[model samples]
Target: MPTIIFVQQDGSEQRVHADVGQSVMQVAVNNQVPGILGDCGGSCSCATCHGYVEKDWAAHMPAAESYENDMLTCAMDVTDASRLTCQIIVTPELDGLVVRLPALQT
Candidate 1:
């Protein structure tokens, strides 16, 4: 399992363990972390799971697909590092992955 660090709106952090192949959103939701609303489950159709990849962690993620890019338009505070957590598959290399949640999801 990999450990994912989720930084919430008020700067609180939740270090949760996750299995490889699980989506980041799934880890957050399963652990009862706030901010990630995975409204469309793990599908890429919703932007409710929006989160930001810290600058140093950005290189660990692949470029967002066109469909994901389209959904992010519905998110708040979308940045160059913005990613929909549901699309972020966990892996060993992401053991210490950091995902910062916005104040709210759209």
Candidate 2:
């Protein structure tokens, strides 16, 4: 398992131990975390799981795929660090990964 740190907009944090094979959105949704809607499930077609990777950790992520880039473009407050949580596959290498929730996800 890998530990993931979800930082909500209010600065609250939930540090959870996640299974390596699950997506980050799955972890959040399964935990009933408020910020990530994951409305479209783990599909990259939806931006509901949009979030910003902590700046320093951005470099550790794989480059955004074309479809992910397309969906991210539809996200609110999309930034250079913006990523759809569902597209992020959790792995032991991602231990301590930080994902910052956006103000809104619909």
Minimal lDDT window, size 10, model 2: 54-63
Off by over 4 Å in 2: none
Residues 1-106 of candidate 2 have per-residue lDDT tens digits of 7999999999999998899989999999988887899988898877999989988987787988998998887889999989999999998889999999999987
Which residue pairs clash in candidate 2?
A: none
- The candidate that wins on lDDT is 1
| Residue 49, model 1, lDDT | 96
- Alpha-carbon RMSD, each predicted model: 0.7, 0.9
What's the TM-score of every candidate structure? 0.97, 0.95
Q: Once superposed on the true structure, which residue ranges of model 1 sit more than 4 Å away at CA?
A: none
Q: How many backbone clashes does candidate 2 have?
A: 0
